[model samples]
Structure formats: C-alpha cells, structure tokens
Target: MVKGKIAIRRITSPKSRQVTFFKRRTGLLKKAKELSILCDAEIGVIIFSCTGKLYEYASTSINSVIERYNKTKRDNQQHHVTAAEIQFLKKETESTMQQLRCLQKYNRQLMGEELSKLSFEDLKNLENVLEMGLKNVRSRKDQTFMEEMRELKRKADDVEQENVELRKKLRVLSQDHREIKGEFAAETSSSKEMSKSSDQAMPDKDDIPERIHLQLSLQPKAPSLDAHETEIK
Candidate 1:
C-alpha cells in the first residue's frame, strides 16, 4: 500500500481492498474533524462499506449533524418533485421564454424591420395599435390646422384695421392738402364734399358678421375608436 501511488484500476484482492477502504475512511474522518475545529465550520462525514455497513462522524453533536443531514435530504427530495410537475414547469418556462422572444421581435418590427414567424393575432393587434395612433395624429393635425386658421383670420383682421386707419389718414392728408391749397387760392367745394363722404364709409359690425359666424360654428369631432377589443388585450 505504501510503495507508490496505487493504480486507479480495480483491486482484485478483497482483503487488501477492504483494508485500504477502512484506513482511508478513518483518515478522511480525522481530517474533516480537524478542519472543522480549526476553522469553526460544521462538518459531517458519512461512509458506507461495500458490505453496506454505515459509518458517520461529526465535529458537533451527532444528532444535530443527523438532523441537518435529514433536512438536506428532505430539501433535495422535495426539490425533485413529480416528473409531471417538472414537465409542466418546463413547458411554462419555455412558453414564457418564447413570448419574450416574440415581444422583442415585435418591438423590432415596430421600428420598421421586416420579420418572419409572427402569428395573425400579433399582426391584427399591431394593426389596431397603428390605426389608433394614426387617428390620434390626424386629430392633432386637424386641431393645429384649425388653430392656424384662427391665427390667420386674426392677422387678417389686424391688417384690415391697419388698412382702415391708413384710409383715415389718407383722407386727413387730402383734407390738409385742400386746406393748404385754399390758403394759397380758393378751394373747390367738390373736394370738401368728398371728405364728408369718406368719413361716413368706415365699416361696422355688419361687415364682420360672417367672420364671427365662422368662429361660433367650429367644433372638434370625437375619435371613433372601438371599445371592446381594447378591453380584451
């Protein structure tokens, strides 16, 4: 036994093999105890002979080590449930992983990548979402268009008011010119009559009634989205 490292090949002699087993088993138990004590670690050792004899050692109380061993055994046994449960859990895990992969694929598709292997249900749902999104975009666009129209109308009103003011100023300038000409000579009676007629020509609320009517009539249309399908998904 002491000549060199023994061959890993099977031992032919029963007596010699038994002797080696006993000696090695004793040495292993001794080492385990020493290591446990030096490091303050819990240790348990169990050995079974070829003849089916059981041997055990523990650094702490044997009963405590045995209780721990039993707990470990129970845990190990419980961890391996029925084969049916294992299969069910495996199927569930596989299905979840597949769904995750499909969701990632769909996300890529939403970014405009061409794809393969998607279901009809996935396609239908995607179409619905896209349609709804487009509808919202159209609604917002219409809102902005209406607002821009209103702004344009307001600018037009401001321009018209400025035009009216300019017209008034022109009339006043003409009147001044007439007065200056009259101071130099005699002014025409027809020019003074033209000034009185121009003052009476300024616009009233009757001219702006159409614009007010348009503002009063504008309203937003509601989105015609379906309710049932959105609730289901």
Candidate 2:
C-alpha cells in the first residue's frame, strides 16, 4: 500500500523527477479514461510537460463536446456574446449614431442656433480667436500707416526741392525786374537829351514777350553698373 501521505516535494534529481512526471502523467490519463467510460463523465484533460509539449484528451469528439457545452450554456441563459453577435451589435451602433447625427442636425435647424451647443470654454476660445483677428487688423493698419507715412515724407522732400527751384526762379525774376527798371530810367534821360538836340523822338516802348522756364531740381542720374562688370587684377 502507498504510505499514509507521500511527502509532496519536488523530486530534485533530474532522472528521478522525469520518472515521477511520467508515472503521474500515465496515472492521470488512465483515471480520466476510466471516469469517461464507467461513469459516462464528459471529461477533457490537457497536460503539459516542463518543456511545453502538449497532451490533450476529450471524452467525446472535441467539436461535439464544444458544441454541447455551448448549447448548455445558452440553455442556462448565459450572457456571452458570440463573434457574430458582437459584429452585428457594432454595425447597429454605427447605424444608430448616424441616425442620431441626422436628428441632431434637424433639431438644430429647427432651433435656429446650431452654435448654442457650445460651452463657455468654447465661447472663450472663439472670443480669443476674434480678438486675435482684431489685433492682427490693427497691426496691419499700423503697418500700412507707417508705409504711407514713409511715402508721404518722400513726396514732401520732392516738393521741398521743387519749392527751392521756385525760390531760385523768383530771385532771378527780381534781378531781371531791377535791370529792366534801370534800363527804362537810362532810356528816358538819353531820349530827353536827344529831343533837346534833334526833332526825332525816342522809339515808343513795344510789348516784348518774356519766356518763363520751370526749373526742376532732379537727383543726379546714377551710373548703371552691369552685374557682369568685374575688375581683374
């Protein structure tokens, strides 16, 4: 007879461990077969070795056993979802979501404000965007003003040059006026003397056309420099 209790410890020696494993494995398989045949028990046993080799036994055909188990589970009102049922549920969910979107859109149209769903945070974000746009507009306006100011300053410089030329022309006209006055005085005296000596009178003053010129002070023309021009030493 076997001892009252065999010490349940690992068989340390390699050969001894292997022998124990083989004996236990055979005994377990035998007991399983006996239970299946004598007691009509539906049994499935899976055994693995330390090296990961597999051994399996089923009292009936594995497929039939699996099918019978599934049927029994269903009869007991198990809530497990089969692969097909899971796929069908996924499709149904997608369809429901699509319909929900259409209904939500229609409801929003009836309500006349689709943006009412936005929360405070969403409004704040929108406000920030609008503020940024306003800031950008102001910045662009300032930049445009600066550019226009620069152009106006350039035009003012040109006007100043034109004014200087006009001043020069005015000076020339003043000098000419003085010369004309002096010539008239000399002619009057000389003509009085000639009348006193002869009957011929000084010629009557005729209308003389004076030509006025508009002088524009232009910047000196810069010499054109060709891109290919180079000094070779």
Candidate 3:
C-alpha cells in the first residue's frame, strides 16, 4: 500500500526529530551527488546538525571549491578597483587639459590677438596686465644695460692696466739703450786715449837724427843713369 504524505511539521519527540533530520540530510546529499554526476556540474553543499556535527558534499574537493570561490571574488574586487582608478585618472586628465586650454586662451587674449571676443572691462584688465609686464620688461632691460656698461668699464680698466705695464717696459728699454750708448762712447774714448799714448811714446824723427843717419848709410845706392848706359854698351 502507498503511504500517506505526512505534513512537514516539527516532531514532538526528540528521537523522531533526530530520525527525520538524518533521513532528510541523506536524501539531500544523494540528490546533489546524482545531479552532479548526471550533469557534469560542480556542486558543493554544507550543513550543520543541532549537535554541532558538520556534513558536506562536493563534486570536487571541498577545499578546491572554496578556494575557487574566494579567487573569483578577489578578482572581481580588483577589477572594480582598477576600473575606478582608470576612471578617476581619465577625469583628472580631462580636467588638467581643460585648465591648460583656458590658460592658453587667456594668454592669447592678453597678447591682444583675440580682442574681438573680449568685453571692455576684460580689455581694460588685460591692458593693465600688459602695462605691468611692459614695466617689468623695461626694468629688466635697464638692468641688463647697466650690467653691460659695467662689463665694458671693467674691460677698459684691464686694458688700461696693460697699457701701464707696456709703458713701464718701454721706459726700462729706453734706459737700458741709454746706458749701452754711454758705455759705447766711453769705450771709444778709451781706445782713442790708448792710440795717443802709443803715438807719444814713439821717438820723433828729429830727436833720432844720428840714428836716422846710420839707417841711411846702411841703405844700398841706386845705379847712375850714365853708368847704366855704359854697361849696356
């Protein structure tokens, strides 16, 4: 005979409740295992008894299933973080580009190149900024001019020092030339004095008359023209 269906209510007897829990747990695990095998699906189930006993079923290792679930969760979190960072950076870049474009537009307006788009007040403000810039530029130009002048003055001082040194050298050379000329004149005078002394120390012809006569007597006489002609004959 077919058994009548019993209503799913709490069992009054502790023993009956325990028996029911055991039977239901067994049936759930058998169905999970069969489903996994038939469908080639990964499945995992975990249950805890009132007495703190653990019951579980998994098509694969329970640890492997748990590890895979955790990994998938972590990857999803990391992907979200990366997407958020990328979006933030894109926004930051766009904001910076906008600021740069604004600055460039302001620069063009300041240079008076885009005056048609400017109001009178904007033009006045631009004019004031330009005037200030012009003043700064002129001040810098004056400072540069002063610097160049100072540099030229310093160079002139250096050149003057060189000129002074050259003049000192010229003076020294002139003094040396004068001293050499004086020495040369003194040498010439000394030579002249030595020649005069040698001439004076020699005996005069008049003072050596007897000596001169002896010299003449020692000389050979020239042949007379008449004697030469007789000899020739």
Candidate 4:
C-alpha cells in the first residue's frame, strides 16, 4: 500500500525541532556518502542549525572542493565573455564593410562611373561641389601666380639695382682713368717743355773754345820788347 504524503512544515516545539534536525542531518550525510561512492563523484553538503551550529561534508577536502568549484565557474564566465567579444567583433566588421561599400559607391559616383542611382537633386549637388572645387583651384592658382610674379619682380629689382651700382662704379672708374690720363699728359708736356728750354740754354760745342781764347786775350799782356825795337828802327 502507498503511504500518504506528509505535509512539510516547521516544528513548533524546541525539543522536537532539535531531534528532527539531528535525524535529517544524519540521513543527508549518509545519502551524500553513498552518492559519492556509487557515482565516483565529488560531493559536498553544508548545514547551519538554528543555534548557529555549523555542519559540512565533502568527498574531498571542503576547501579543495570549493576552490575547484570557483575555478570552474570562473572559466565558464570567461568563456562567455570571450564569445561575447567575438560576436561584437563580428558585428563591428560587418558595419565597417557596409561603410566601405558605401564609400566605394560614392567614390564611383563622384568619378562619373556609377551615376544611374543618382537623382536630379544629387546630380545638382555634385555639380555644385565640382564648381566650388574648380573655383577654389582657380583661386589658388591665381594666388600662386601672383606670388611668383612678385618674387620675380623682386629679383628683377635687385638685378636692376645691381646694374645701377655697376654703372656707377664704371663711371667712377672712367673718371679716375680720365683724371690719371690728364695728369700723365700734363707731365709729358711739361717734360717736353723742359727739354726744349734746356736745349736753347746750352751753348754750341765749337764756340766754347773760342770763348775761352777771347777771355785769355782780354787779359793784359806784357808789352813785347822786340816789337817796340822794330818800330823805332
């Protein structure tokens, strides 16, 4: 015959509760020991009495069992985290690929290769963008040209100034040469004049001896006695 099920309730009497706790605790421990032996499994049980007493059992050391459980739980959590990260990476890669494709299509449209998908408004916008870009390019070109022109003008001015300086130096050199030539010509003329005056002042070589004879004759000569006797005879 099958026995009726007993209702599970808290025992109201203190003594009865203590007795029930002891019996249940012993039975639970026995069951755990049998399960561990028969199944070759590690098992653990823990209980706390109402009086704050503690009881525990384990096929292995409790500390070792607890440590193994924590290690397994941590490993499982890490595996889940790794799977989540992989999923996130996959989604990120898909999003990036989608963006890349969009960019490629947009680039093709800009190059006028894939324009069938563009509406009139989009074409107008593209035209405006191209026009603006052209305007900016032209502006930059003009700016660069002006800058180059200014640089050339500056260089030309420098060259012109240098030429003017060279011309001034040449004029100074020419003036100095003319002055030196004039002084040389004056010195030459003075030398020629001095030579002519010296020629005019010098006496002839033939007259030099005659002039010396006249000077000797002019000196008082002693009276010739023979000449005076001849005259008296």
Highest TM-score model number: 3
> Cα deviation in Å at residue 83, candidate 2?
34
Identify the runs in model 1 with alpha carbons over 4 angstroms from their true place. 1-107, 186-233
Q: TM-score for model 2?
A: 0.36
The residue-by-residue lDDT of candidate 4 on 11-63, one tens digit each, is 89999999989999999999999999999999988889999999999999889
> Per-residue lDDT tens digits of candidate 1, residues 186-229?
44577777877886786666758887878777856565567656
Q: Which residue pairs show backbone clashes in model 3? A: none
Candidate 1, residue 85: the lDDT equals 90
Off by over 4 Å in 3: 1-81, 192-233
Per-prediction TM-score: 0.35, 0.36, 0.50, 0.43
Global CA lDDT computed for model 3: 0.93
Which pairs, if any, clash in model 4? none
Residue 205 lDDT, candidate 4, scale 0-100: 90
Per-residue CA lDDT of candidate 3, range 1-233, in tens?
A: 99999888878888988999999999999999999999998888899998899999999989988888899999988776676889999999999999999999998887668789788898888989999999999999999999999999999999999999999999999999999999999999999999999989998768698898899999999999999999999
Better of 1 and 2 by lDDT: 1
